[model samples]
Target: MQAYQVAELTPGLGADERREFRDRALSSARNPSQFTQLREIEGYGEARLSLIERYLLQGTPDASALAAREAVALSAQASQYAKAMEGRYVAALLLMRRVLLGTALVTGLLSVTSALRALLLWRSEMDRRARREARQREALSLASHELRRPLQSLLLASDLLRHAETQEQRTHLLALIEDGAAQLASRADLTRLNDLYLDVTLRPRAQDLRPLLERFAAPRVELSLPLEPLVWPVDGDRLRQIVENLVENALKYTDGPVEVALREVGSQPEVTVRDHGSGLSDTLHGQVFLPYDQGPRGLRGGQGLGLPLVRRYARAHGGDVTLAAAPGGGLQATVRLGQPAGTRAETQAAGGAGLLQARSDAG
Candidate 1:
């Protein structure tokens, strides 16, 4: 059943009572029975009710025109609010899209970079392993080659000694045995020398360089050691090895008297071994330190490990060994030992020269 829907218009109604009456009318708009009952109220004349009646029910041209204008303006205002909410939704969606795209891009880049880094590291490790294997093979080959001649000589000497005819023959056979044994001893020394180069824990201690030099020098060799004790950091056994190698190399190759000198150069302690025979050409000087590389002057049968070992030992001490043409002729071998602090950094730049290559790169 239809009910009148006009808001109660009472002359004695308070503001609160009027608001409550209007709310009741709006709440019942879906039910025509409520509006039908309210419309039949005798003298109700609320403005909202008049607009509704004129626009919807009465259908008078002038009243409808007024109601239509009011309804159109209110609809436009409501549409503006709805459009604002729709714009906010669109903006929020675009922002979310941008965030998702950026996250995806960053994640992709990071993944690619990580994969690339891992591949590069793996390749480097593989290359290092290959080089190490190659070096090991070369060392074995060198060892076999070195040991072969001596081994043959020892075997021959043993056979001859067993069937010796006289004391002289036996003595000669024994000398051959001694030479073979010496060759084997030299091979063992070479192995020890390699170990010395690779040893990182070889600590240098303060030592007097003058006496060390003099001890290795023969009486015939001229010594120009510093009058003031050239005290420097050195490993005693290694220093002796360096001195003996240099002195021996000098005397072995040259006809003239060998000169041994020790002096301080900057923070480094320098030892110079000079001989007065024809020196090597410029090109040979650089290669003289390379393993198994003997210069043009060194054509005679000799294992070419001496200069290389000297260089390796000197470098291991955080210093360097250099060979140059001496003034007035012959070759000069100079050895420099670094201060302890400088050695740590040199060990970094040594370029895969010993066991330190792995440890330094890892650091």
Candidate 2:
């Protein structure tokens, strides 16, 4: 007989099954031989049976039998506790999965929103560029119209002067014609200006800074340079205009000497123009580069286009210009541009002689 057979044979084994099985086996015993036979069956301990018999017939159950019942009860309680713990673990796993799913959804939404914002910003930038180009074309057209009228007048005046009868009348007509021609020449050609502007704004060309600086160094203004040549990709005409404007402005601000210098600052080329005159005011330093901006004293001679043009030209070359107090209590304008990629040997070997000659003439 096994534990299963003992369980099946026990009467009312549902409540206190182990104890009921023990009591039933002991109660049916008639003699020691019967008790020993009952003990021979599985799960029927001799000590347990004797204790049950004593408890039922003699009113004295052993301590060992009571301890066994307590152990069985404890095992049942532990099993129930294990089932409860398993349910809680499953619930926690489900909650964690739900939290992770929500986080993933939020991250996806944020990525989508960021992408949309970038698209909108790109569209806005494109629109702004289109508008700026349109405005630039309009300005060029207006300048062309203004320039053509004076040029036509000068041409007609010259034709009339060439065909004049009296020497005195001819002389007067010639003077008038010369005046008209000078006026026309003073105004810049819209096409050339526009072309230069495009070159500065769009495709910049490689230029030798040393030669460019040398070209602008007039006898009226003192100039300085480094021993080595500095080169960069830049708009040549725009850079010329910037240098011219700075020099002209310096001339205007001071009857004293004006100095210009070019040097390499780390990986870039730097151009500095210094004028020894009454320095610019702290308030006017930042505003001087703005279009139509006059200085604090309202220097009335100019149309206030010089510094503004210089600023525009510098910016177009992917560089910046700044005004500061010079070492000798004067105004200093500095322009910085990215350096060209080449060593001296490579530059010399690659037919740089012709370029150097051309640059010398241009300077």
Most lDDT-accurate candidate = 1
Report the C-alpha lDDT of model 2 over 196-217, residue by residue, as the tens digit.
4333343455566776677566
lDDT of 2 at 59: 25
Please give each candidate's TM-score: 0.44, 0.44
Put down candidate 1 lDDT per residue, 1-363, tens digits, no spaces.
Answer: 011112232366675665564444334433546433333331222234445443544434454455545444544545555676689999989986775675575567567557768989999999999988876665554555446556887999999999999999999999979977876665545556345443323556556667667755566588887666565556765676677667777877877799988887884578899988788889888887777776776635656766776776687777888888998889899998875434455545654263233324323
lDDT of 2: 0.64
In candidate 2, position 156 carries an lDDT of: 80
Q: How accurate locally, in lDDT, is each candidate?
A: 0.65, 0.64
The stretch of ten residues in a row with the least summed lDDT in candidate 1 is 1-10
